[model samples]
Target: MIILAATPIGNLGDASRRLVEALETARVVAAEDTRVAQRLMQALGVENRPRLIALHDHNEREKSADLVELAREDDLLVLSDAGMPTVSDPGFHLVSAAIEAGVTVTAIPGPSAVLTALAVSGLPTDRFTFEGFLPRKAGERASALGSLADERRTMVFFESPNRLADSLRAMGHAFGGSRLVVVCRELTKLHEEVRRGTPEALAAWADDGVRGEIVVVVAGAVPRTVDLDTAVQEVLLLTATESLKDASASVAAATGLSRRTLYEAALRARTR
Candidate 1:
């Protein structure tokens, strides 16, 4: 059996009773970081001496099979440095391997920085998408934010403190300066803060440079300042670089326009 456990993101007191019992009795555990696991065990006052193995992004693929074999004989516990494993953390490969081997896969749900930040974001929560982490490069990050300019569902993202300000400015460029945003810093921790403002305001805040784990929650998109003609022009602009079909689909997505209509318009523009 493979048990995916959720460790405390902050406030060790949030550790569940089941989590403690499981850690107390488990003979073997795979952790994102062996040292962090030991520290956690010490903090939780668990006396069990479980064999700890490293299972991070670097070795997850090569080590997943061996871990699965161990789970076949004994209950193998999987955990990350924080939150649930595989939510922008390591665990998917192991879970997939366990499933393929007919090993029972279960989870002990607990503290999640994403959900925690979203709940306090003061934004719509009924529909939201968790975009784990954005690309680091300026061009790529800008392109990523540009693609979401029309995302109507509330969007959540994990970002490092260093990149927070630049990301906010890039988001402002893509989604407009006045778009609503919430930056949750050191969530559930002593320095916990939830700053609410426009992307421009937050970008200015980031300019000051801050430290802590960060989660960004942005309000859902509003209607675009586009009409049928404007949407067709956007399709045409993209078609200069992207295939006509691809351009039509992209523009339609961004403008909530009809793909077929955009395609036909682009086709007619070519003839004229």
Candidate 2:
């Protein structure tokens, strides 16, 4: 069996009872950083010195098979430096390999930056999507945000402090300056701060620079309501530069209208 354990994001006291017990008994542990795992065990007062194996982004794919094989004989415990493994962290490939090999996989769930940030974000949490991390480059980031311009579910994203300002600036452009955003910094830590405002507001604040692990939660786009005739006209205009299918899909996505309805309306309008 393969055990994926969640580690505390910051506060050591948040470590669950099951996680500590797993650490104590596990014969082998695959960690994103072996050094960090060692430190964590020390911090938790766990005396058991399990064999530590490095299983990070650099080697997760290569090590998955071996890890699965190892698990066949003994429970293989997986840990990231912080939070749950394979959640924008290492362990996804290993879990997939384990599942494919018919190896049982289970999780010791605990702290999660994604869920922590979302819960404290004050945004609508009834429905949400975790966006992981944004592209590092400005152009790529913009293109990614642009694609999600019409996302209706509240969005969660992990971001580095250094790039937070620039990302927020691009978000202001893509998601609009007035869009509500929450920046959760150093969550569950000494300097934990949650700043809520428009993207433009937060962008300006982050321009001075910020620090610590960051999670940004943004309110979903307001659904656009448009009549079929108006939507069809918009689709027709886009068809001048895009395919009929592409144009219809784009307009439908933006307007929250049925793609088939838009396509048919635009098709009939084009015939006229």
Candidate 3:
């Protein structure tokens, strides 16, 4: 069986009893960083000293098969540097390989930076989406955000401190200056901070420099309130150069109106 374990994001006390037990008895452990795993064991006062194997982004694909085979004989515990493995961390490939090989896979759930940030974001949490990380380059990031400009679910993202300001600035441009944003840093740690403001204001504040692990949560876009008459007009205008079906879909997506409704309305207007 392959076991994916969750490590503390920052506060050591958050480590779960199941995770501690697994670490104590596991014969072999694959960790994102063996040294970090060793440090974690030491911090937790776990003296069993399980054999640690290095498994990180650089080598995950190459090592997944061998690790899965190893698990056939003994339980393999997978660990990332922080939080859950394979969540913007190493281990996804291994999990996939295990599933493909029909190897049983289970998890020891615990702290998660994504959920931690989202819970305290003060934004609506009824429905949300986790967008792991934004593109690093300005143009790529802008294009990426542009695609999600109309996303209705609250969005969660992981970011590096050095790029936080620039990403926030790009978000302000793509999502507009008035969009609400929450920046959570060093969650569960002694110096944890949660800052909330518009993307523009946060960008200005982050310009002076910020540190530690960061998670940014942004509020979703408000739905447009265009009437059916206005919406059908848009569909009709686009139909002059495209298929009615294509135009209906395009206008419906932009206005959050029903595609069929727009199509039928436009069809009726055309007949008249």
Clash pairs (backbone) in predicted model 2: none
lDDT of each residue in 1-272, candidate 3, tens digit only: 99999999999999999999999999999999999999999999898888899999899999999999999999999999999999999999999999999999999999999899989999999999999999998899999999788777899999999999999989889888999999999999999999999998999999999999999999998878899999899889998899999999877767789999999999999899
lDDT for model 2, please. 0.95
lDDT of 1 by residue, 109-218 (tens): 99999999999998999999999899999999999988888888899999999999999998899899889999999988999999999998998989999898999999
Structural similarity to truth (TM-score) of each candidate: 0.87, 0.92, 0.92
Stretch of 10 with least lDDT, candidate 2: 248-257
Off by over 4 Å in 1: 225-272
Segments of candidate 2 deviating more than 4 angstroms: 235-250, 258-260, 263-272
Ranking by TM-score: 2, 3, 1
Per-residue lDDT value at 225 in model 2: 90
Pitting candidate 1 against candidate 2, the one with the higher lDDT is 2
Please give me the total number of clashing residue pairs in predicted model 3.
0
User: Residue-wise lDDT of candidate 2 within 1-272, one digit each (tens)?
Assistant: 99999999999999999999999998999999999999999999999999999999999889899999999999999999999999999999999999999999999999999999999998999999999999999999999999899888999999999999999999999998899999999999999999999888898899998999999999999979999899999999999899999999988878899999999989998998
